[model samples]
Target: MAYFDQMGCKKRKRGERVFKFKTFGEQGHPVEFKGSFRQNVKSLLAFGNLGNSLCGGLASWSFQLEVHRNPPEHILLFVVEEPIEVSLNRHCKHCLHVGWGNHMICNKKYHFLVSSKETVATCFGYYEGNCNESYSGTAGKFNLVEFQGHVMHGVFHSNGFGHLLCINGVEMGSDLAGYQIMEFWDRLCTGLQARKVSLTDNSRKRSMDLRLLYGVAYSEPWFGRWGYKFGRGSFGVTQQMYRKAIQAIQNIPLCLLAQQFGNSSHDIPSMFSRYQTLSGHFLITLRDLLRFMLELKACLPSENGSIDTYHSGVLVDTTCRWSPKRVEMATRVIVEALKKAEFRWVSRQEVRDAARAYIGDTGLLDFVLKSLGNHVVGNYLVHRCLNPVTKVLEYCLEDISNGFFPSQEGSVTNDSELRTRYKITRAQLLKDMFCLYSHFLQEQKSMMNTGIFATTSLASRVILNSKYLIKEYCGKLPSLIQVGLGENSDVYCTIRVSHDGEVDEGRRKVIVPHECFMLRNNTTFNELMLEAEKSFKEIYFGLRNFSIKSIANLNAEGTDLVFKVVKVGGELVFEGSAGENGLNDEDVLEGFRRDSVVDCPCGAKYDDGERMVSCDVCEVWQHTWCVGIPDAAEIPSIYVCGRCEKDILEFPSLP
Candidate 1:
């Protein structure tokens, strides 16, 4: 016979008959056999006695294998520490433990027999649905030794309840085989602290099936005969339950982690370490739940119309009224939180300044003030000089005044007709109103301490200058007329009056005839002369005449060169020329002869065949038609020439 060890078979012999035997050992460690087969076999069988004695009546045994063969045979042996009941059953003569022997029947020897106490578990049946069939099991018993180990005792409770059954010492059960091995280990560790460990292979699979139900119920509560129920304050029990389930999963080793670190059978240390971090995983899940709750709350309807669930909770009536006060409150809360957080705080003044800057020159402050209505804040601002309404009014009036009547000259004449037509008074009421409002704003609270009024004044001056230029060229009238000016019209002329009551007419003096001067007609020559004289006097009121060294006559005829003779140094002197080129020219002499047939100054006949007559003195002939003369028949006498007549008058004694 050959002694069987944990590894395989070992050679053995007795006396003259050689025997082969096989042996088994604990956990696969080889057991050494000494001496003959009968001696070692007896010793190996006695090894169970030592375990039984040490366990104090609790059954214990050792695994042993022996094999017998022909001459020159080999003996195989194996040893293991097991319960005494397994050893007794294997050696009992009348027991059906023949399969537990280490000897092979033919060429093959028995590897090892599973102790009767080892549990045998296998998948029985699976349910079909949305749930994973790998997780579900049916009520039925089946031989499972091929899958795991042999079953010791099995029984089905009443009505398929309490299906608990113990197997051999090995922890093989349906719970262990129901799900993947990794998942099985995961669920095994979840409720480990409660001492309610489920060693069955179906533990993980059953939990997974339960989790599927949880998921389905969470999504469609009515599908599982459950009514819809929202959680208090936006957090629901279903969400919590889901979180718990995830937490349970995290308690197990992640498949990737396990594959990397665990061994083929079991790796308790690494699994324990992974399970220790379950609290952190739970915290992460909690954070995710909180985020989900916040998102849900944000999407929920508040003061707005109820949400329409028909289209997956879309808001149909979007015309919801939001409370400004509530919005402000919420904003304040957020701001406070932000301030308290690890960041900087933004001041209210800074925000206001930012808003003001954003508005730029749009005058939004005025708009805000105007829209404030009769609120307490509005009233307070009005009392405190911070009133935007008053400020806008002041700005508007100032703009109008500065943009209309600008200079004293243009202001008086522009829009004179419109002023009259509209029956408007030229009083500075608009300007005064703006000034009073500005004064009120400044004196009440001094909101602008940097002399904004001065800036306004400067801007007003610029505007006034611009308006004056526009009125001057375009002939547009000012909004208001001056006191003495007529209505705005083209007939009006702007005349500047000096401190001495003299008017300025550009390079000359000009006096206003009357406010209604443009309304008059049929002016006489005397009246024209008097008006011209008055205009000149008014224009050159205090101007002194420039000293003239000599007076030169321009190319003109007749009295065009009138002489004002004066004896500056006791001498007879004429300031102008004589004869036709001077004051006493032929043209002047011709005016004196009404009907006289005067010869031309070039000594030509009055009636020349070529429409031209010759002058006798200067010898220059000009045609009567060319000279614009009416008729020669209108002359009384044709006697003296033009130049001869002038010479006779200039020097009468010599003539």
Candidate 2:
């Protein structure tokens, strides 16, 4: 207290960015809290009852932080605290070394946060998504962290950043919607020592995603105020960048006398970045970096636009007059074209060329196409990106199984487009994303239902209505580009995979253009196997996995030098790889739907690790449930499934 008071500590004013409070501590504890911010904290009342691990050693975890999610509309915002247990998945054991930590199954995931009342609840749903166990390995962590109950729940990486996966309840118009969210978010970020939260809006129209459907003070515009959403291929101010710059600049000695010059203000970005402050509580902003220390001023728009100070934020407010009804009326015009499209996915150009006959207004035509997100309405579903190599396509996620995906729904063909480097551009993709966002606005102004929505868009109203945050965000995300959508294209390369045995097989070289679209690194063992299937048919016989290595770096071992080369432009085609596959109950994943020979009465395969039994009469395998039995129930000495019993019983009855 004596230190801060003498050093110019003061109460935070109404609009100023700088503020200091009374009270101080040794700062040795993991999560030290001062009394002032206590009122804003949310308490996890049943933390003790939940009984989670304190310092971790119970099992293993990649990370140990809290997660917050926006549940679908039907889910209750506040419910009685439900019991949440965590566990690990044995099937996922192979990935433990790779950073896919303990999953939530057999009580392996519940590790409680201590005395911090901010941890009042512990109700994250069925399983953990991201790697929350040991930090060494990363599973490109994307986990389904369902909220069992409570406003905020779930365990995430303690040292990881906050990810706002979805935006819900905001349109419901509750003042507390944004308040509770911010409270939980702030607590999560503060505890994790994270600088900013990352949230992306990927709504492609059709399904009425909440990112759209709100106005002036709600929806995406609302989040705009607190955070800056950069444009295409943009990034935020990161500690990694600062550390890199500091490492580079530290070699140059500080020019102490240079600070005395009249031009010190311009040197602040350099000065603030160069020196590390003695105080541990404060966070430096981009604004602070540019005109921070020298001006002796506080942080201030960062504008929520770009990572740098020069660029401004972007806001999209489109006025669309389109709706489900309009598309229906123009059915003969649009549906006819969609039906005749060649590929499973239709491109925007294909759409324009097809609908040009009946659609008179160019803007209206464009809006109709853009608004048709990858979701199934009455006739068509908005299908997007396609993969030619894998023959797998992404349909409007809103309704992948809307009775129409690969199959036709009544009249409209299940259409998607191949986003090969030749067809789609980064600029076009970014433009279309915002264009679909505008679709929400265009919902035939009358259909916007703003009159009733006046009561909705809850969170945004709460955030702006009451200047809860002093440095309010400017209701705009100037940059709305998806990640990995850069100008960089795939290069033609040669990959030589050698078989282990010395007799028949030796090595086969796959000389193909490295793919740019696949989520995994350009080339992988499975990909090489698939590409060289004709050449290495015997090697890839049943479920044989291979070790892949780049011919260029064939000799590089597990030394740090190889890592350095890979970090730079150097490509390290590691032996082999994989990702966290979701727990699909029915066991059939359309994404991995290759040809299969499982003859179950129930038209499902991909087992997802469900129990299966052999039918004694026919010698065919069937899922326990499909043949009238429990998964854990004991099997009969001589079991006969319904399929086999049907014919035998019918034959006896006929005789």
Q: Tens-digit lDDT track for model 2 on 522-564?
A: 4443453344332222112111233333334445433223222
lDDT of each: 0.24, 0.30
CA deviation > 4 Å runs, candidate 2: 1-147, 153-180, 183-210, 213-219, 226-571, 577-655
lDDT of 1 by residue, 17-135 (tens): 22212213221123243222222233444533222221222323333322223323232111223222222222211110111111111110011122221220111121112124231
Stretches of model 1 off by over 4 angstroms after superposition: 1-117, 120-208, 211-655
Q: Candidate 2 clash total?
A: 47
TM-score quality measure for candidate 2? 0.23
- Each prediction's TM-score against the native? 0.12, 0.23
Per-candidate clashes come to 88, 47
CA RMSD of all predictions? 60.6, 27.7
